[model samples]
Target: MASEAAPGSIGGAGTALPRHVAIIMDGNGRWAKKRFLPRFAGHKAGVEAVRAVTRAARAIGIEAMTLYAFSSENWRRPEEEVSDLMGLLRIFIRSDIDELVQENVRLRVIGDYRRFAPDLVKLVDDAIARTAANSGPILVIALNYGAQAEIAAAARSLAAKVVAGEMAVEAIDDAAIERELDTHDLPPLDLLIRTSGEVRLSNFLLWQAAYAELLFVDTLWPDFDAAALHQAVTTFAQRQRRYGGL
Candidate 1:
């Protein structure tokens, strides 16, 4: 997790890099267990990894990054762990919003983030609004987000539109459904990475990642840094994307 790692290691390989990237930040608890520290410590360090990866993206000229901060299924975990996660969310927003604003990174949330505590919800909204006009890199945090739930919500939205005579049933298509999704504003997903040797998507961006190249790395989330990101992109560069065609 070297902070000073150079971003040029990724973008200068001559092969194309993904315009948009999503990460399933996994293995924080395992990382903590390996170090004999509480899981909360790993989550806290994972926050720094988020910062590092965001910086790496900006430096390497990537477009957008989406992080799976917390999933809807995470509520099934122990109450104290969930509480620690919420607290870390508060601290990350309050402390990092200024840096994000100054860096011209637009912040977006994909999940039902407003379901959190009123104060915390306000904090997230304010932070988002503060960075709304940034023109360069984008950061999307998926907190309490589930792809299935998002898709179902989008379906309901389309159904309502049809009922209101705004859209014909025949008008429903892949593009129409996509426009109703939380990631509608983002460019098509180009790469999806899961750290800590995880090989599954775990309900993150199932539809958008339909054609995106997948990378599962062994590094834990807390230890993933710029160099690791560069390595991932480099690997992505070497693959030939057929997009389901020859």
Candidate 2:
């Protein structure tokens, strides 16, 4: 990772550099294992990678970035690991809000807020509020988020609306379904990158990424840097995004 991130190594030619980049950050535990360190240490180091990627994206003129910080499936992990992640997130919110504001970056979280601790939830809300007016890149963190759950929730909400006489059952369409989703106002993803050599989507952004250019890399989440991102972007640039048709 260190060798890859050395100056003048990233953002090379053929980098498609999509306006919106969504990442499924993976492999923190594996990275820790390789280093013979605790998994929590990998998570901590991943924070630094997050900062680096955000800065790199901003510098490279990307408009939006969505990171899969924690998925709904992650609850199955050990309690200690989950607790450590929550702690790290709270600290990240407290420590990074000012920097986010200063950089004109807006912070958005897409996930089940109810699952987090009350204090952590409040801190996240506060951070979002503090950065709400920023005009730079929009940084979205998916905490406790799952596309399947989002779709189910949207369907339930739509069903409720139909029952309440607010919307007719026959009137519900794709647009209505989208409006019911948490990502209703966000742009569709242009590129989806997964690190740690993982080729699977792992249930991240299923709907939004339907038309996105997908890229996978061997670099672990804790080690992913500007160079890794540049590689993904460059690969994205090389592909012709047909969007399901020629």
Candidate 3:
């Protein structure tokens, strides 16, 4: 694991960057409402922001970036809106797969896919398979994910092991539970950013973000750009991460 240096530690040329960064993309509906356009329009524009940010993260040397794309709670949205969002996801995958491949960016989806439509699940699987060989930074998309549910599932899995005598109940530790989570293979989360002025985690990466520095920006998801990402990263580089130590 690549641990971050203490605050104010300068690297060879510039400030050391976070190894892993996660984002909560928010305010698409509000952006569209303010512009007197349908909410779906904002979602379409948000896709462009995702592309821009992905390129920016890769350029800035971030090892991994996780995006809170669709939440498990999003199923309560209006039928038409949900349909539109799903359509946008498909379009994004199809249109951007080539670029991602060329850039050596690996696409990984971390969420429960059993509830997704078969075709949508297939598209996700295909995207992951296609990018499996990429050596560059990873782009993790959280679709239909809920942090509480994920934690409960991990706990249940461990409980089953104890019941079957496969593991001792007292042996359960932070590291043991982390291995069962969806982000097990990714780098430790270093920074978490929420756009549109939201200051809450909103059920995103609850465990992984335990020690991550949080940044809240007022920019809507549709309006977010590389410059915004750069600013957030620059701010992150200046913060001290004590992790309970002085």
Candidate 4:
């Protein structure tokens, strides 16, 4: 467990209590490489980090937390690595679904997760259904997701609506496009953090993070734990979000 991060109080650290936080978990392969271990070893280790971070975020009163589990480009990796990742996903859901249900965390996913094998898809769907009614924190996993594709798809949807005379083209503003986005149900992204010292978005959340606070740290995904997460949130608390205004 992490030391409590006091995001509700804003006196000392300013008023930026991030309601939603997203993280780009990176450096798993590198972490394994440095240890002379298989890349799967680091990825497997990263799962523990995910669990710890989820628990810590829930404890901190975060409304929603999104993790970049797999991007569309990830499929281009070695087939063995991809298979290992899928196996890990199955293991995580099977082993942790009960715990998530007990904790009242609602499980949700963005992207074409069905692209996975039918058995794995069923497992994921069952897990989602199991936690659909939970009233606690929402956990969003981006599997096979890409920001550019998401935006382009949303635009296509709106364009289709225009063609069908459902909504006029002039009405397609920010909110309109947002409704078609994968994160429409989740709270507005308040903080976007990338581990492993990566500063770029790397096609994570293009539209939702227009004004979100961005933080990059050098911690590897496999080593990221509750304390690192709490520290990141505390640092986020100290920043003042101008949102394009002084």
Clashing pairs in 3: none
Task: TM-score winner between 2 and 3, please give it.
Answer: 3
TM-score of 3: 0.94
TM per candidate? 0.95, 0.91, 0.94, 0.95
lDDT of each: 0.90, 0.85, 0.89, 0.90
Q: After TM-score superposition, what is the CA distance of residue 6 in candidate 4 from its true location, in Å?
A: 6.8
lDDT of 3 at 98: 93
Residue 225 in model 3: shift from native, Å? 0.5
Model 2 gets an lDDT of 0.85
Clash count in backbone of candidate 1: 0
Task: Give the runs in model 2 whose Cα sits over 4 Å from its true position.
Answer: 1-16
Model 3 agreement with the true structure over 1-246: per-residue lDDT tens digits: 112323233222378688899999999999999999999999999999998888877776788999999999999999999999999999999999999999999999888965888999999999999999999889999999999999999999999999999999899999999999999999999999999997899999999989999999999998888878877878988899999999
Which candidate tops TM-score? 4
Worst 10 residues of 1 by lDDT: 1-10
The RMSD of every model to the true structure, in order and in angstroms, is: 2.2, 3.7, 3.9, 1.8
Error of 2 at 49 (Å): 0.5
Which lDDT tens digits does candidate 4 get at residues 131-208? 999998899999999999999999999999999999998999999999999999888998999999877999999899
